[model samples]
Target chain A: MNAAYVNVSTPHADRNISGIRLAHNRLKVAVFVFLLAFLVTAARTVELGVRSGAVEQSLALDIVVEPVQYGRADILDRNGEILATSLPSTLLQADRFKVQDPVVAARQLVEILPHLSYEKIHSQLVGKKGYVELARQLTPNQKWAINALGNPAFEFLEDEERIYPHGRLASHVLGFVDVDGKGRRGIEGFLDYRLSQTDQTQDAIRLSLDIRVQYALTYELRAAMNAFQAKGAAGLVMDVNTGEVLAMVSLPDFDPAEIKSTVEGARFNRAAQGVYELGSTFKTFTLANALDQGTIDLTDSFDATKPLRVGRFSIRDDHPKNRILTVPEIYTYSSNIGSAQIALEIGKERQQEFLGSLGLLERPSIELTAVGVPQLPPTWGKAATMTVAYGHGIAVSPLQLSTGIAAMVNGGRLVPATLIHNSEGWQEGKRVIKPSTSRKIRQLMRMVVTKGTGRYANAVGYRVGGKTGTANISVVGGYDRKAKISSFVGVFPMDDPQYVVFALLDQPKGTKKTFGFSGGGWVAAPVVKSVIARTAPLLGVAPKKEDASLYETVSLMIEE
Target chain B: MRRMVTGLAVITAMASGAAVLQLKLAVQDKTDNVRKIVQDIQVDERAIRLLEAELAYQTSPNRLQEQSNRFLALMAPKASQVLADPSSIPERPAGARVDSSIDLTVALEPEVKKPTKKRLYKRKGAQL
Candidate 1:
C-alpha cells in the first residue's frame, strides 16, 4: 500500500515505490538528529546562565562604562578661577610577554620616563592582576615617545586626570588625591563624594578662597617667615560680611600634587589644626564680651596701677602702667590688668557664655577633614575667666579666632565660615551682638592698630585697624620662654569693616627691621600690612579714595 | 519532468537560504570593521593632539627661559647691562618705566631688532 501511494507521482510507479522506502528511513533519522541538537543547546545554555552572578554583573557593567570615563566635572574658585579640572592625559602600558628581553625594554622605558623604576614596572606588567596600570598620567611629550615604541598589546585608556594648575599654592586647603583620584584634605576632602562622580563635573566646587587674596597673604607671610627665621607660620583672611575665607595658609605647606613625600609638620593645617594661646588679641574678645554683657562701658575706668595678683599667676601687660586707665585706653594698650578687671565685672559665667557665643570654645567652621578640639579650661572659674579674658589659659585655632573676630566686628552678625562661596544674599547671618556694640568694637580694634601695639599694621589708604598678640608657647615642661607665637589680627577701613586678616609667626627670631624683637608688632604686624596692601587691588577693593558713610561711627570712636 | 521540477525547487531554496546567511555574516563583518576603525581613529586623533601640544611646549617662551637658565651657568651676564625690554610685556603701558636696577637681561631679552639670527645665547657646561 505504501509503495503504491509513493508511485502516485506520474514520474513512474516502480521508481516511486523504491524512493518511498528510502525517504521514510531518511526522514526518521533527520527528525531524531534535529531533536538531539536542540536538547543539547538548551541544557548547555541553562547551566551557564545559572552558574555565575559575577559574569552576569560584568555583562551589565559593560553597558554603563562610558559615563565613568567621559563625564568628569570642573572645579572653580569663588570668583571662577579654574582651581582644578579633569584634563585629558595619556597612559603608557607594555606587552610584557611579547617583550623579547626585559632588560632592553626596561632601559628604553627609562630613557623616555627618566624617573620610572624598572623593577616596579616589570613586576606590575608580569603580575597576576589582568590589567596593569603602568602610568595613569602621561605628559604630551611622554605619550608621543611611548607610542613610538609601537607594540600592539600596549593599551592606553584615554582617561581624565585631575590637574591643579596653581601648583602647591593652596596645598592645605585644596588637599590632594590618591591613585584612584580621590580628595584627601580641605574642600577636596569635604566635597569628595560630589567631586568623584561623573555627573557633578559640570557643576564646579565653588570655594570661599579667592586665589588673588590667597596669593597675596601667603606670599607676604612666607617672606616674613623667611625674614624673621621663624620656625613655622600661619595666616588667614576672612570676609566680615559673610565669614568667607578669602585666604588661609599654614607653612610649611606641602605640594598637593606629590602628596606621598609630605612631611608631618608640613601636613598639619596650622590655621585650623594647631591651637595657640592667643596673647593680647584675646583682650579684644574680653572687652567685647564685657560690653555685650553690659558689665562695663567703653569709657569706664579700670584699676591698672599694678598687675592683678591671681594665685601664682599675675595679670600684667607687656608694657604696664601705674594709672587707672579708661576702658578704651586699656584695650588700646592691651593691658592684661584692665582686661582681667573687665572680665571680673562680667563675671566668670558671663565671660564663658560670651566667648561661647563667639564660637571660640569650639572647633573652627571650615571644610577640613582634620582639625583640633579647642582646649577649654575644665572649670571656667575666676582665674580661668581672667586668663581667657587676655587670651592666655585657653587655646584656639587661627581660623576660629578669625571667624570670632569677624562676628564681633561685622555688625554683630556671625556668619559661619564656609569653603564654598554662597550665592549673593544667601547667607542668613546669625546676629550675636547688637549693631552698635559691633561698631564700638570696630572703633576699639582700630584704636589698637593705629595708636596701640599694632602700629606697624597701618596700611595708609586702607585705614587698617588691628591688635597684636604675643603668647608664650605652652610646652610640656612649663611654657617655652624663648618660643613665642607673635600674631596680628587686622580689619581694614574699620569705619565699615569688610575683612579680618590674621598673620602669625611661630618662634620668630627677630629681624634687622624689628630691631631684634620677635613681638607681634615686629614679626606679624608688618606681614598684615604688606599682605593687605598687595591684596587690596587684586580683591577689587581699590585704595580707599572716598571714605564710605557706613564707617562714620567707627571713625568718630577712634578719631580722638 | 516532475522529478526534475522537485530537484530544481530544493536546489533553488537551499541556494537562496545560503545567500541570506552569507549576507548576515557580511553585515556583521562590516560593523566590526567600522568599530575597529572608530577606535583606531580615536587613538590617532589623540596622538595628533599630543604631538601638537608637545610642539607648542618645546617652542614655548617659558621653555626658552628655562633652557636659558640651564645654559647660562657657564657665563653669567653682567648685572648693570641687563635691561627688560618694555615691548616684551603684552599689557604693559607704552611708557612703562622699568627701573635700571632690574636684571631682566640676565635671561632671554628679545630686542626691537627682529628677523636676525645674531644668536646671543649662553654656552652650556658639560652634560650631566
Candidate 2:
C-alpha cells in the first residue's frame, strides 16, 4: 500500500513541475518579440526624421506644373477708356471621319451661321480630308447654338480677336491689326512686342491722348475743311510744358476698324508726314533768333521803301508799310523785307544753329513711324538764308513746326513729344532759348492775335497769341499761285502759356465769307478759335475775366 | 511559444500595412478634389473676362453718341452755355414758383389696391 501511494504522488508532482516550466518559457518568448518590435519602430522613426525634408521637397516639385498663357494686353487712354482690347472667340471645325452625314451637318451649320456658305462646308466635310475649318470668330451665342446640335463630328477651337472701341475717333494713333493678330500700323505696329507679351499681370498701356479734346479738334478741323473747300487738313493740340500731345487729327482719317475701306489719301497722316514750306510762320523764328543773339533790338528799324532784290529773286511784303519800320512794326505788318533784313543781320551760321537747336533740322522725334524729314537746303547761301527767313526755301512737317514753337513758348525748353502717358510728372527738358527771349516771343505772338493778321483768332477771354502762315504750294518748277497751304499756330493766355494749337488747310479755296481771301487768318485761325472754345472747358483751363492782367503782361510796344 | 511570437509579429505588420494603405488613398482623394476646384475657378475667370469685354463693347462712346442723337434729340452745349464758375450761374427768377400741388405719392400708388376691412369701412364712411 505504501509503494502504490508513492508512485501516484511522484507522477503528479513531476507533471506539475513540467507545466510550470512551459509557462515560464512562453513569457520569455513574448518579451523577446516585443523588444524586437520596439527596436525596429525606434530605428524607423529616426530614419524618417533624417529624410523628411528631402521627401517634402520632392513632393512639392512633383505637384506644381507650368502656368497657362493668356494672349495680349490692352491699350487704354489717359482717362482709362478702352482704346484697344482683345476678346475671346471660337472657331468651328469638323472631323469628317466622325461625321454621319456631311449634308445634314452643313445645312445645320449654315442655319446657325448665316455668313458661312453651305456648299463650301459640304465639300470640305465630304472630301478626303479628316479635318476642316467651318467658321472662325464665332460668337458665344453661336457656339452655344452649335453645341446644342449634339454633333459628335464638330469641334471648337478657342482664339482671341482684337477690337478698337472708339471707331474713327483715334484711328491714326491707335492703328489697326492684321487677321493673324499682328500689328500693322501706328502705335499698334510701334509697340507690338510689348502688347503681345504672355504675362497678363501687367497693366494696360496708357496713351497721353484725351478723347474729349481729340473729338473737339477733329470736329472743328472737319468743319473748317468743308467750309473752305480744302483738299485736306491737319490739326494738333500739345501741352507746351510737357510736350504731351492732347490731340492729333489728320483729316481724311480712316476708320481703323475697316482698314481695307480706307482711301489712298486718307491713310496719309498729314500732321506728322506731309512736309510743306510753311510761310510767314518762320518769321517768328527769325525774329526770336535775332533777339536771342542780340543782333537786332525791338527799336531797330529796317528800310522797306521798296522790294528788296537778292541775287535772282525779289523779296516783297504782302501788305507793304513802304517806310522804315521798327522790329515790332515789321512783325505786326508781316513784312518780308524786314524779316530778310533781320535774317541778314543774324547771318547764315546763327540761323542754322538756332533752327538746329529747336530740332527743326532733323526728323521729328515723335512716337510715330510716319515722321517726315525736313527739306533742308544743301547750301546755306545768302539767297537760301533770305528765302528760309520768310519760310520759302526750307520745308518742314507741321509736327516739327508745332514742336519748335512749343519750345520757343514754354520757357525755352525743348521737350520731346510722346504718346505714352508720363505718370511721374513733367519731364526735364533741354533749354533751347533764353527765358527772356521766350517771354518776348510770347508778346509778339499776342500782338499778332490782338492787332495783326491773326486778329480773328482772338478767343474772347483766352488771350490768344499766334502767327498766320500762307505759303503757295510749290510745283515741279515753281510755286503754284492758286494752291496754297494755309496754317496758323496759336498760344493762349500768353503770359503763362499752357497749350499750343496748330492747324493747317491744304489748298483752301477763296470763299465769299472773307471777300475771297483764303489766307491763314481766314481759313485756319478760325479753326483754332473754334477748337479752343470747344476744348478749353473740357481740359479744365479756366477762361480769364474780360480785363485780366494777362492782357497787360503780353502787350507789345509798337510805333504806330 | 515560438508559434505565438510569430503570430503576433505577422498581425502587427498586416495591421500597420492596412492603415498606411488607407491613409495613402485618403491623400489621393483630397488632391483630386483640390484639382477639380482649381479647374472650376479657371472656368469662372474665363467667363468673367468674356462678360467684361461684352460690356465694354456695348457702352462704347460712339454708340452712346449715336443713341443720344437719335432718341434724346439733344444738342451740343455752346461755350456761352458753359459757365466756368458755379457762382456765375444765374439765380432762379422770383416769378418762377414751386408747384406744391404735385402729389408724387398719389401717382406712385397701385391702381388695384386690395382694400382691408378698415380701409373699406373708411371709404364707406367717406361716401356716406
Candidate 3:
C-alpha cells in the first residue's frame, strides 16, 4: 500500500519471482512422478493377482476332477456281474540308504512273506545305493503286516492284481492276464487295447452270455461227460434270431487264475477252436439245399436200400431203413446213403456253394482269438461231395455246425455269431434260403426228435427238434473207429424256434445207464434235453401247451 | 487434482495387495483341503471297488450252488412249475371267506414235521 512496495521493474523483485516460478515447476514434477509410481504399482498388483488366481484355479480343477485310473477295466456279464477285475495291491521296496540294518530287515520281510527268498531279499537290500524292489504284487494283508514292523526304509509301492471271481466257469471266454497285465487269450486277447486303454474313464465290457444259462450248460455237459466217461466235451447255446451266443462251455477248462500250471490240452477251447468231423448234422444242410434249389420235394424218394458207392467211398446209413425213403425220412433217420445220393443230384458246385452261404466253410465270425478255420476237402469231386454231404472229409468246429443249423431253422437267415451283447435287439441277417425251405427243415428236424434217433432229446412240453451226429475221429491215415464224436444240436419250442443248443462228446465210452451205447442218441441227446428243460424258464420262454395238430401232417408223412 | 489422484492410486495399490495376499492364503488353505479330500475320495473309491469284487466273489454262481446244496436246498423253478398265465391257477374253493390275513400258502408247504412210518405204526398199534 506504500510508495516503496509499489515500485515496479526492480532487479530484486524480478529475481525473487523467477526463483519462485522455478520452485513451483519442481514441485509439480515431483508430484507427477509420485502419481506415476503409484499407478504403476497398482497395475502390477492387479496383473499379478489375476495371473496367480488363474493358475491356482486350474491347479484345483486338475486335482479335483481328474478321473481315477484303474489298471484295467472290468469284464461283466449281460446282467452286470463281475467276471474279471483288478484288485489293489502293492510292491514291496527297500530304501537301501535309509535302512540301518539290512540283515534284520530282510529276515523280517521273509518272515512276513514266505514266498520271498531271504537270500535274494538280503542281497537286494545291501546291493544298491538307492531304492530296491524286493517283491511285486503284495496283498493288503502282507502290506499291513510289513507296516507293523515300523521300518521307515520299507516302502509299499502301488500295484494291481488281476482276479477272476468265477474261476473255471468262463475260463475260455475271459482268458488270463500275464504278470504285467496284458491279455493273453480269448476275448481278453481280442479286445486287449480296449480293455487296457486309459485315455478316459473306462466302463465294464458286457458280454451276451447269460451266466445262468452257462451254468446249466456246463452242469449238464459235465454230468454227461462223467456218466459216459467222455475224454472231452463241448457245448453252446445261441439265440437263433439274433445270432448272439448265450452260453459256451468247453470241458477240461483250466482255471484262469492258475493258468500257468494247467495242462496245455485243458487250455484248448474245443467248442470254438477244434475242427472235428461233425457227422450227420450236415444232412440238414444237404436236404435244406435240395429243398431250396427245387431239386427235390418232400415226397421225393431216394434209394437208400444199399450202400451208395461213389468213386472210392461207400456211404451207408447209421440207422438204416433199407427201402426207398422219402426226403423227410432220409433226414429223420440220418441216412448217409440218401444224403449222398441227394448231394450227387445237387452236384459238387451247388453243395459247396450252399454250405458256404450257410457260413459253414469259413472260420466262424465270432469274437474269439482261437476261431478254427474249416478244413475243406482238397477237391470237390464225387467222393468228396458224398462224404461232405454226410459231414465227413471236411472238418468244422461245433460253433460252425451250430451256426449252420441256426440258419437252416431260423427262417433261412444266415446271421454271423457274436459274443458281444447287442443292446439293440434282433438285427436282421442276410437271407440264405426261402422261408418255405426253412419250414420244411424245421419239420424234418422235429420228426427226428419225435420218431427217429433224437427221441431222447424230446424234453417234455418244450417240443424240442434236433439232429444227431456220430462221427469217428479221423486219424492220420483214416478214421479211428473206437474214437467217436457224438453230437446233438437241438432247437426248442419247435412251433417258434428261439434257441439252438448243441452238445458234443469226444470219444465217449459206454456206461450201464446208457445201455452201453455211446451214440449221440444215448449220450448227447439227453444232455440237450436236460439243458433245454433247465434253460427254458430262465430265458423267460413260457411253457407252451402241446398242440398236436401242428405235427399231424408230418406224422402222416412218416406213418404212411 | 494431482494430490487427490495420488491418494486414490495409493489406496488402490494397498487394497489390491492386501486382497491378493488374502486370496493367496485362502487358496493355499483350500488347495491343501482339496488334496486331502481327493485322497479320501480315492480311498473310499478303492474300498468300494474292493467290496464290490468281494461281493461278486461271494455271490458267484458256483459258490451259491455249493451253498444251496449244503444249507438252503433250494432248486431252480422248473418250466412246468412256472405258470405264465394267472388264470391257469385254480380258484379258491366256493364259499371261502375273503380273509386277507389268512396265508393260504402255509397249506401248500410239504409236511416236514410229519411222523415217520415206524412212529405211525406204533401209534396205530397202541390205539388198537
- The C-alpha RMSD of each candidate to the native structure, in angstroms, is 12.1, 10.6, 7.1
Q: Model 2, stretches more than 4 Å misplaced?
A: A1-69, A93-135, A144-155, A546-556, B1-128
Clashing residue pairs for model 3: none
Docking class for candidate 1:
incorrect
Q: Ranking under lDDT, best-scoring first?
A: 3, 2, 1
lDDT of the candidates, in the order given = 0.76, 0.82, 0.86
The residue-by-residue lDDT of candidate 1 on A109-149, one tens digit each, is 77888788989877766666655667768877888877797
Candidate with top lDDT is 3
Candidate 3 local lDDT, A143-175, one digit each (tens) = 899999999999888888888877888788778
A326: Cα error in model 1, Å: 1.1
Would you list the clashing residue pairs of candidate 1? A73-A201, A208-A419, A495-A551
Cα-based lDDT at residue A390, candidate 2: 85
Give one digit per residue, the lDDT tens place, for model 2 in A1-560: 53654476677867766876798899889889988987898688568657767675665414443333356777877777777877777888999999999889999999999988989999999999888888878988999999999999999998877777667877888778887788766788778888887675246889988877787788788988999999999988988888888888899899887888899989788888888999998998999999988998877889999999987778999878799988877887788999998999999999999999988899977777678899997788998899899898899988889888988898889898878887775756998889988888888888888778898888876778899999999888878989999999998767778888999999999888878889998899999998887677777777765444543543445554
Instruction: Give the worst 10-residue stretch by lDDT in candidate 3 chain A.
Output: A1-10
The numbered model that scores best in DockQ is 3
Winner on lDDT (1 vs 2): 2
The candidate with the higher DockQ, 1 or 2, is 2
Interface RMSD, candidates in the order listed = 11.4, 4.2, 2.0
TM-score of 2: 0.76
